[model samples]
Target: MSTVIRKYEPYNRFKGYLVENNIKQREVAEVVGLSVSQLNQKLNGTRGDFSATEIRLICKAYNISPLDYFFYD
Candidate 1:
């Protein structure tokens, strides 16, 4: 049997996007209809993953593609 190792940090990409674009977490939560605490939980990996609607709203607000949020090198 063989094991595969991956070095992907899922949420970091989103965090990086926010930092790069100067987007505030509070504003994003408001626009996405999430509570600031909820957004923090999601971003901090304490809560579950973002819903599809939330993802769409974040992308829309930042004028970014979903790909940018998920996969940035």
Candidate 2:
């Protein structure tokens, strides 16, 4: 069975936050413990799959609650 990925707007929001903070994408990748290329791919929508650990890391990095990043309709 195929897994359905829910829409998560926080990725864009998070990117904006990073830019607003003058945080480089590579810096964010290092801070979030993700590879720079991997993070770039994710940001570009070339990768839509992320692990639970990644989600937690992202939330931690952005200081946003996990629940705030996601919703299902």
Candidate 3:
């Protein structure tokens, strides 16, 4: 079987990050200043996108660099 090399998908990576960190969606929603329902919409691609400030806030909340965690593939 050929191995599948997946290209980076931002939302998918974010979801994986939540899982890997054992974090609740509500917790992340709080970090990003979004309501749980709003976060769900964004994560599911129904909403537009996360603002830069929101992303920065989330990275800061987790004590991570946005460039390292988010901007990278």
**Candidate-wise lDDT, in order:** 0.77, 0.67, 0.75
- Candidate 2: which stretches are off by over 4 Å? 1-10, 70-73
Residues 1-73, model 1: lDDT tens digits: 8753323334788888789879888898999888999887777766777888888888887788988675446
TM-score of each: 0.75, 0.61, 0.72
Clashing pairs in 3: none
User: What is the overall TM-score of model 2 with all chains considered together?
Assistant: 0.61
Clashes of 3: 0
Tell me the tens digit of each residue's lDDT in model 3 across 1-73. 9863333333767777788999899999988778999887776656766789888888888886666556654
Candidate that beats the other on lDDT, 2 or 3, i.e. the better one: 3
Q: After best superposition, candidate 1 residue 48: deviation in angstroms?
A: 0.8
Residue 36 of candidate 3: its Cα lDDT?
98
Distance from true location, Cα of 30 in model 2, Å: 1.6
- Minimum summed lDDT over a 10-residue window in model 1 is located at 2-11
